[model samples]
Target: MVSKALIQEISQLEADFCSALSDPTRLLIIYSLADKPHNVTELTNELDIIQPTISRHLKTLRDRGLVYTVRNGSSITYHLGDKRLTQALDLLRAVMRDRLKHRASLAKETKATINA
Candidate 1:
């Protein structure tokens, strides 16, 4: 059995992960990092957002232990810290596909009812 403290710790970790994903910009950052690591300037250029905004979101992700940074010369590049992030994204895609299929089925059923 898990100890109460362990459970609480796990809950807190989950909350932190969710918090990191709370912003669409953060999610986009994660997705971008999934392909390749990037410095703040690269992320800003690719995301079409401001550098400070990207840096702010990257800081949040770093605080959550979701991203890691490496210094190359004067620039710091960021990448996903946990490999599980890729798995999590895959699972999310699967769920989205399922939801879309369900919606299509429901729409078909409603159309049938209307025609009947």
Candidate 2:
């Protein structure tokens, strides 16, 4: 059994995870990194975002332990720190799909009722 303090810590960690994903640019970065490791320059070129912005997001991900980096000569390449990140992304996609479908169905029902 988990203590109250442990539960609070877990909740905070979940909040941090969601916070890290709140930015669309950051999400894109994570998805990009999911495919393969990339250096800051490569990521900046691929994302079309400024180097500082990419570095900021990368710092947040690193601080949260969501990504791991290694030095390749003078460049640092980043990769997903956990295999479970893919599973979590898959779960989130499924939930978003279900919610979107539900909203569309509701809108269709509302339109039909108004036309009836």
> Whose TM-score is greatest here?
2
Q: Candidate 2: which stretches are off by over 4 Å? A: none
What lDDT tens digits, residue by residue, belong to model 1 across residues 1-116? Answer: 88999999999989877888779899899999998899999999999999889999999999889999999999999988887887987898799999999999999999999999
- Superposed by TM-score, candidate 1 places the C-alpha of residue 37 at a distance from the truth, in angstroms, of 0.9
Q: Candidate 2 at 2: error in angstroms?
A: 4.5
- The lDDT of model 1 is 0.91
TM-score attained by model 1? 0.85
lDDT of 1 at 47: 91
| Highest lDDT against the true fold, candidate | 2
Residue 1 lDDT (model 1): 88
Cα RMSD for predicted model 2: 1.4
Of candidate 2, the 10-residue stretch with the lowest lDDT total is: 80-89
